[model samples]
Target: AYPILAKHNIKPDYVLALERHDLVYQCFEQDNQEFDKDILFIIASVAHKSVIDTLEKTKKSYILVHRPLPFSKALHMDDYGYLGSGLSVANMAYDLAIKLGHKNIILIGQDLAYDENGNSHPKEYLHTQESENDRKEGLFITAYGGNGKVETNQWWILFKESLEYSIDTNSVTTYNATEGGARIEGSIEKPFKELCENLLRENKPLFEKPQTLSEKEIQDKKDKIDECLKRVVILGRSYINECEILKSDLARCLENLNFENQDFNPLSQRIYQMKAKFEDEEFKNYFLDLIRSIFFHFEYKIAQNYTKNPTNIEEEYAKRKEYIEIHINWIDFIIPHIKLQIQSIEKGLS
Candidate 1:
């Protein structure tokens, strides 16, 4: 694929590679001969320390891309552009392309669904042992071209939805060059060869170097981050205190559990209201991703146990009390870490 791309002189301005994908390393190793010297590689951040170390050791000219999480936004916005919180790496790349002011973008190898051969990813990344039974049990969905069936899963369905949403909402003119996969709505389907031919004929600008922010812009962003950090710290402390109060109240309610006249509607409503505060976009944008996950997990557990009208009040109370204690302990465990993160951010900004 690289050799064919090089033969046609079809150089992309940048390649958005997710660090989680082994294909990123494979391309640099195997296709190094076909790579243009000017092509910039933008890699997404991975959680694994080994992968991070490997990426840092690479000699390739690249920038690490990060989602608009609190820390990344605070630090890397000036150097590396922020990719919005989209479900998949493909969606992140698309968002990054939009941010880079690319109006005419072509997507290649964005097969959101499995191929006809029952492979989840391309041949390069399929190192895992997959059984025929596993392949047979995979979900079937209509292919992007609407001709045949393609394999997909729930996560892929979510990714496809996210891709569709990104394309539909953005002003960019997107062309899908993938020959197979689930169809991404709002993108024009064209063969990769034909798209490249048209691009070569038109002498299109395939690459654009990202611009650095001005000093004033950088200072403004720092100021915004500082303000956000302060707000989040305050919110975190307040939430912990509130959770303590709720935990005590739940304990008292559990102590006086009445099976015949049991009514937890008010308690459930209160918990729902508390959970709704975390659902705010401002909170999501400002809080640390792990902290957000913790909060979300607590809310999910609470919803699962307490939200529904229970058939057996005493049995439900036992479960609810257990979860409530767990939630309280979890909050206690995380609040200090949240404070530490706030302090770190403050120190870094200073």
Candidate 2:
């Protein structure tokens, strides 16, 4: 658009801008209309029940672009609008120009902020402002590359096509200004500049330095684990007390204990070992299997003997207490080794 306007040395009398929001279209209509006036109409989707009445009542036209599906997908167009390689807003503008039946359309203020005069938009503007009495309201050409290294080639594609078409004598004149977007490339642009004026900030500095912990940090972790162990031991006693309450019925008590012990033992041991094997991972799984088998056996025994031998409850309590003490000794021995493992980890980290 900028190239076309520059080729003919013509500044546009009317400009047509398209956005999806009707309210925004209305704002541009009312406010900017008093300034270097151009007709700005919102091409809203039929899906949005936007202020259609206001659009209709306004002096400018409010066109509805119909689509098969609802307009949910188009909401993210702002983020991905630069995806196309060559064809972008230029193609759209061309279509729009043809649709509006305008043979002599001219564009302005689209200068993408580049200069054929060996200057960037800022430098040129600063020089111009210093020398000229009155500042120009807008630029005339559309240029793409910014101060950043990561260049967007989409603008190049648009400029390529725009320049090629501007050579035609019968077509619209395109004028490109040096700068276009509100910010440099790769910078975050807030949706509404006025509303988010204070919210937007400069990009955060990247942290490239390595992060490492000190020897003291590693030792501190060991001390924390030691503190945790003491609390766990206190709670272990409470669990033992709860286990004692179910000891009155020998079969029921054994079944409950068997289920509890199965975590350290398993049913597969009952078939292969016929007894217990201790300490190894295989032994641990076997132990759980053995406990499950015992639980099953006790349940069967309880159902069979409960009616005839209900008074065997006293003997059952004694046997249960004996096994409880055995478990406590096992736990006391295992705790010291567990503490050693934690110490080893701390030493390794240090």
Candidate 3:
């Protein structure tokens, strides 16, 4: 795709590569394709270390876009950072485009669903063998050209939904120029050539100067980070205390063989309180991913048990005990990481 685009002298204003898509850079290098240096390469900050190393080795100019985490606020892009709510890099790229003030954005090669040949990504990119589970048909969505139905999995559906929401909620006009893949609602479908032809008359420069943070903004960001770190310390301590209390209650319940009458209300209330605190608007832009990561697994476990409807009383008792233990273990696992994060933030501040 890179070679074909290069052959046609098509130079995008920016190449929003997510994480391991550094493979795209390799393709360019191998082909000896020299693209416009001004083409901004926006990469996710949490990208794998290998991707970072590869980019550094290739000496490519790029900006690291950061996503909001539970312990940290979404950094301002003017400070060379970006925030995305979705997990996929495609969603992050879309966010970057909106942040760059692109009113009219055209998406190319964003095939959220597998192609007819069951190819998830372009051949040049790294290919992971699709598991039987992954290959299983789930939802059916209109193909890019509206020519046929394409099979999509849950994750791709999520990406499509996020993209659609972003498009609907933003003032930007989005167009799908991929000419293949799953259809993204709210984005008009247009051929690549036609979209280019329409834009050819525009005299505006393809790329804009990078937005940099003012001195005051930089100071404000630092203050925000410091405050966030302090809150994390408090939250971590509170969580540890709650976990200890829950563990004691669980132990007592097990001792008395009172599983049927056991009251989880107190534990539930504590967790609810924690969630409420975390969801505060002041912390909304912060490390939501971290909070979700710590809680989501446990929540899923509970949900899975409910779905299975455990019938045996003893089995139910064991499951409940296990759940409590898991929560305790998670708290133990997370506290050290939280302390470490706090330390890292403090060190950065100093």
Candidate 4:
């Protein structure tokens, strides 16, 4: 506990744990509140059931925890799953810090375990392990690889992806003791730093720059979308056999809802075509609409909450505004993914 906390050199308002491991709790107990009482210590893990059962009698805010909701797994598996937990950490930290009126927060030891020798401990071992005994069983784990070099590439990939997904205008200076994972991945594995850096840099110049499309670029995008669409149309021919069965189920639902135009074929086909051969112009319009719609929904939700039942008036107002701001920033992160996917499809067509 001392080593872990000391290694980071900074204290978190909340210590989030997937499981109430004895060690984690011990650390929580030993550590003095360097931050404020507002910083919550949350414990969440699959094994939290046992802890909750045992400590049911005691009511203390110090040991606050939440279980992973099963339904949420469908949409947010990556955010809460084994590999996704790292991303969750960054997200939670950022949220907690922002709530506490912090602007610049440091991300501590997000380093990945190195693959020294041929054998090495995997970072995901915690999520994959079935029981406490299993995690404990791996104590004698050793590596077979010859070189004793540590590689954090895998951990870095997930960390960067998460940070990209969660980071906002707030300045987060990640203090990496070793080589920063983002730099290594961007430089070595792929020539993606130009794109990633442009998107992530805080100067705001990139955002303020004019978004004008060249004729050649538009034409190129059009040709690629055409080719991709043809492939999707072809694929739909193969799905015709199952269409009859699926339609029956779909029709029943539509009818029950008192829908008039019961036509899934055209809608499904259109969506397939759009996904396969997306028109840059059409996509630009559609994506903008989609994003704006999401933003509108978010704004309305926030506004409704603030206007209606007012709880934690100040905190709620701050959170509602902050979340809306995060949504806009998140749109920036999503743009690259959309562009890349479109580009990949275009290249495939070419």
lDDT of 2 by residue, 100-177 (tens): 555433332333333344233333242342332223333333234334322223454355455355434334433232
Per-residue lDDT of candidate 3, residues 1-350 (tens digit): 44456556777655555544445444334322366455555666666556556556656566776666533333433444446667676787788778768889888777888767775665444343242235546678888877789877878888888989999999989999988888888999999899999975767655556688899987987787676666655655665566566566656755665645336556546556755665676444444444557667776776775565567987777666666566566566555655665566567667
Candidate 2 segments whose C-alpha is farther than 4 A from its true place: 1-17, 21-26, 29-61, 66-91, 113-350
For model 3, the local distance difference test gives 0.65
RMSD of each: 5.9, 29.5, 5.3, 23.8
TM-score (C-alpha, index-matched) for candidate 3? 0.69
Full candidate order by lDDT, most accurate first: 1, 3, 4, 2
Q: Comparing candidate 1 with candidate 4, which one achieves the higher TM-score?
A: 1
> Can you give the TM-score per candidate against the true fold?
0.65, 0.24, 0.69, 0.31
Model 1 ranges with Cα > 4 A deviation = 1-12, 19-36, 45-52, 70-81, 126-137, 205-288, 304-323, 329-350
| TM-score, predicted candidate 4 vs. hidden true structure | 0.31
The positional error of residue 121 in candidate 4, measured at the CA in angstroms, is 6.8
Error of 3 at 14 (Å): 1.9
Ranking the candidates on TM-score from highest down gives 3, 1, 4, 2
Candidate 4 per-residue C-alpha lDDT over 1-350 given as tens digits, one digit per residue, 9 for 90 to 100: 23254455655445554543453333333333344234444555433444444333233233442333431232232322331233445555545555456434444333333333322333334232222222222222111122233443443355555554445344543322233222322112222344345434574222132355699976876666575454433433333323334444444434453222334344335434532432344343323422445446655655664465436656544544443343334334444444544454455566
What does the lDDT read for residue 246 in candidate 1?
Answer: 72
Would you list the C-alpha lDDT of every candidate in the order shown?
0.66, 0.37, 0.65, 0.40
Higher-scoring candidate on lDDT, 2 or 3: 3
Q: Please say which candidate is ahead in lDDT: 2 or 4.
A: 4
